[model samples]
Target: MNNFVKTTVLGGLIFLTPIVLVVAIVGKGFSLVHGLAKPALQVLSVETVLGAATIHIVSVVLLVLLCFLAGLYSRTAGAGRLGNWLEKRLLEKIPTYPLLKAKLRSALQPEQLETLQPIMVRFDDSWQFALLVEQVKPDASLVFLPGAPDAWSGSVCIVSGDRVEPLDVSVQRIIQLMKRLGEGAAPDLSQLRFGAHEA
Candidate 1:
């Protein structure tokens, strides 16, 4: 193939790939729903009055309930550990999981302040907003300092132990500030002492 033709074909394939995948996935989901709903319709005999629409609607609702039940179970102590183990062994292998992992973690653990401990970490001369992911050691900690307009992703930096200053702020509030590209309201970090270094 000529250079122009090759480039055009590659561009077309790139555009069509996701569209085709979406269509295929949607079609398969509909087929599965139809199959499952058919049995429920026959058992309930709701199809006689409400028609086929009832089956599809009920199926979707039931599916949502099932997902909720699963999520509730995941929030438990034992099941959560199992799920985490399985995810680490299997799901983590997927490249996309690491990308969306942070987003999902926030959604799943809304009340867990420790999920992303909002902190005001000091650099050599200045203090920048950061999230404390975890403590590698008593002194060493993993921090994620996000960029504005898209705090969903960021650089993982391990700052000096003394430079890391804890902040009395919410992760959601910081995320909001970041989403606006720091053009709006800022988190109240006045409570956090940025005084002389102390262990």
Candidate 2:
């Protein structure tokens, strides 16, 4: 009986969640617009600069114009270069900036980076886990261990070559597993081996 009730509630949530989310988002957006307009309307009316409807219309028009300008700027080569320059400069000034940059770079790195080599980690000479290399130094290596909830970001360990195993896996597959199962799960190698043998 308890299991039946739990299953029913879970099934209902699975079916209704998207609809609820959409309605909540729309309602919140409307509330925010109303809040902003209420204060703006009071100020505009005191000066007789615009009626409530006119003020709302003007605000919307200004927002659209700003958006258009922003879109144009983003598409321009000069703006793109400026943005990148600013990002690098700002990152250099902040103490925690390099860590954030590393995470972002790891996340956005090309899929080709994933196929370079899989680091095989052995635990006590018996257990083994595979990791994708994020960066490597002479003494330490940055490896992304697939963990539950998020896979793109993982521990940065200083592992020796003897402690690491190298595997030939495509970057795309690693990314797919990261995206689908977070870090807690990985692609099933046994299945792949069986399929390869069958083919």
Candidate 3:
């Protein structure tokens, strides 16, 4: 009974942490942008035209414009060098920053998602679905074992290539399966081996 409660609570945390972090980050950014734009709105007396709602509308517009400008700037060669410098010198120092960056990139960039190959990893008597992150060596593969309920909280492992079977499935499909807590995965689950490992 205690183990079940602990497991359930942990699963809930895993599912909520990403959502909470995203909401908190966006809220903080909006607050900062709104604070900066508030004085300007008051100076221009825009409140007289739109009344109380003007501040929010103006803040949102400014935030969107700022995001557009930043995206444009990041496309330049200098931005690439600056980004690398910041990551190596400052951003990488923060423990969660790298993981956050990778997750964000994977979410926003389709090409990054394409690179993550779906596969089945032999784990004792059962098979676990994972993403083939990279080929660490000729016989060793780096894989991401996604956690159920929240795929982002997965763990990375370097396993033997022989134990990893590449699947004819998409990364998005695998993520959806994880998000659904492996429901409707009977066809895939049927492939799990018993007793002995396969070559």
Candidate 4:
């Protein structure tokens, strides 16, 4: 397919996915409130005392209160630890939980979290964009060279810090550029005057 079409679809999916996810979550929450409040609404004969609106209003109020209480409880000392324990024991075993949690976290974090540093790597005759995982010493860094299209598979190398010219770009942008296979995504490296291995 053409790049324009591919980019348009990709952009649409990115915009719509979170919206769909939020709507789904709210829909389920609404259903839960309806089922849970039906008996209470009927028992008190609230529909007659107030009106048909009473049932729906009561259900929504109860749902909000229930959510507030749950959030309040999760922050307390004992409940916090208990929740963590339960998550590790039960939620962690669910195959997609960790991946979903990580994606959610990355989305929620600030735009520049600075967990990784993008670097233009030059070693001998090879040059590529890579992430500086860590710098154990002043002149050495653990770098990861991510594969194009799917960056999850990559090789790690211990490269001299001198040969890795750090880029003043966000790691997320670096990943996106690599995923696009350098299609108008390469970072500016003209300012890199030193620490290049003449690639």
The digit string of per-residue lDDT tens for model 3 on 1-199 reads: 9999999998776556656777897788789999998998778766466688878887888888988999999999999999999999997886556556656886889577898899988886678889998999999999999877667678999999878887777888887898898898777656555444644
**How close is every model to the real structure, measured as TM-score?**
0.66, 0.38, 0.80, 0.54
True-vs-predicted CA distance for residue 181, candidate 4, Å = 4.8
The residue pairs that clash in candidate 4, if any, are none
Q: Give candidate 4 regions above 4 Å deviation.
A: 1-30, 44-69, 120-133, 136-163, 175-182, 187-195
Model 1 Cα lDDT, one tens digit per residue, 1-199: 6999997786566445545655676667667767887886788766456666787777677666766788899779999889899898997885445545566566776677457787878875567889999988888889999766557656898876777877776898888778787664443764666656544
What are the RMSDs of all candidates, in order? 7.2, 10.5, 3.0, 6.3
Off by over 4 Å in 3: 47-49, 89-99, 188-199
CA error at residue 177 for candidate 2, angstroms: 3.9
Of 3 and 4, the candidate ranking higher by lDDT: 3
Model 1 TM-score on a 0 to 1 scale:
0.66
lDDT of each: 0.73, 0.55, 0.81, 0.73
Q: Where does the lowest 10-residue lDDT sum fall in candidate 3? A: 190-199
Model 2 scores a C-alpha lDDT of 0.55
Model 2 ranges off by over 4 Å: 1-109, 125-140, 178-199
Model 4: per-residue Cα lDDT over 126-179, one tens digit each = 678888889988889998886666453457899887788878878787667767
Model 2 TM-score on a 0 to 1 scale: 0.38
Q: What is the lDDT of residue 197 in candidate 2?
A: 17
